[model samples]
Target: MARMPSFLKPPKKIAKRQLELRAQLWPDLNEGDLWSRHTHDGFSTIPSTMALIMSIMDDLSKNKPVSSTYLELWNRSFDEGFATLAKAREIAFHSGFSSERAERTWKDRLKILHNLEFINLQSGASGPASYALILNPYKVIQKHHERKTRGMREDKYNALVARAIELGDISLRPADPSPPPTPMAPPAAPFTFPLPAGSAVPPSPAAVPSAPVPPTGVPTSESSKV
Candidate 1:
């Protein structure tokens, strides 16, 4: 049997020891209002390393930290991997943008996040940012690091990688390339009406008989000679 690589193995003992220490230091920690996804009615699961991810996102943006905005989206998202951002004003307010330009500021942050590939947007009845499909942040960060994206903080990326390795997270790996689009079948030949069985072909315009013309000086049915 092949031996598993040490680097790939999770630190079980260390994690257990940390948990024991936490229990000792805060015995009533579990009794507090700490929310758990399993027990909570309204909660969304997010990565444990979200703080680091947010910092990385901030670095990539090269502007104000957009962590609050991202968090708001996450909070609104369900397990379905998408979020309805119909209440743009509410999201903006919650994301700490309470000024007259709050919504605009939120939109700018959304654009930054979109450019970084963290979330995909689609316009809907609500507005331009009506719907947001959250991407795997780990994969996004990994790709950015691989591509050497400008403004990506190496230290934060390295920490994220180490944490992912410790947690045996597969999301850090690249996804399989999507299959090429199927070619569209040629537009069906213009529909033609099938001739009915035993039906004769219709005569051409020239073959059809036309009304006879009266001679230029001759009286017709409407005119009588006296």
Candidate 2:
């Protein structure tokens, strides 16, 4: 029987999961979204650091349950659009995040996801940590680029690694797509407040009485003294 060398130990299940999560979370990281200056900062500096943030964002995007502690932050400050924190938590607590640091983990991951446009940051007194889940732009660009560049006869991709020369670096960031149009709701039907039946409508501004005059023969001087 052959024994495994201590130097080449078997990898943990979490490592594979973490990698899978990252691939799903950020298929194409955009230059615009990357915090180059702050990239080296915090726990995210770990090799798979950005993946963790993407996992958290992915969880939120799926409309899953979240830690109540973190949900409290959104309830008081962040907007999740239609779904409340409590409602989200019910789905989340049942789905996963049963661990202790579940809440703190979310808070930390969200901090790294700060540049996401729809996420609102809470500053000043009684601050709460929360983020709004929006569509990831990086993934969209990759799909579009692939569609346009597909079927090209680029022989370099299959050439020997040592001899292969690649073209310009692909850009992850794309121009912000225009937001969806919000329905106008027909101007709310002009908000007509019903008047009592058979009652005469009040006079228009033109017919309303003008400013009143002082009583005839009233002495302004004597009135002021009294």
Candidate that would win on TM-score: 1
Q: Each candidate's lDDT (Cα)?
A: 0.86, 0.41
* lDDT: worst 10-residue window of model 1: 31-40
lDDT per residue for candidate 1 within 73-186, as digits (tens), equals 999988888889888999999999999999999999998888889999999998788899999999888888889998888889889988988978877755799999999998
Write model 2 residue lDDT over 1-226, tens digit each, in one string.
5665655443668668876787789989665665543233322112122233233334343343233333333334323332223333343344344577554555554453343322444443324542344333334323423554332122322221112123222324345899999987765556678889998998767776777677898777659798
Alpha carbon lDDT at 224, candidate 2: 79
Off by over 4 Å in 2: 1-95, 115-118, 122-127, 130-136, 139-226
Relative to the true structure, candidate 2 reaches a TM of 0.22
Return the number of clashes found in candidate 1: 0
Which residue pairs clash within candidate 1? none
Report clash pairs, candidate 2.
65-92
Please list the residue runs of candidate 1 whose C-alpha ends up more than 4 Å from where it truly belongs after superposition.
1-23, 26-39, 174-226
TM-score of each: 0.65, 0.22
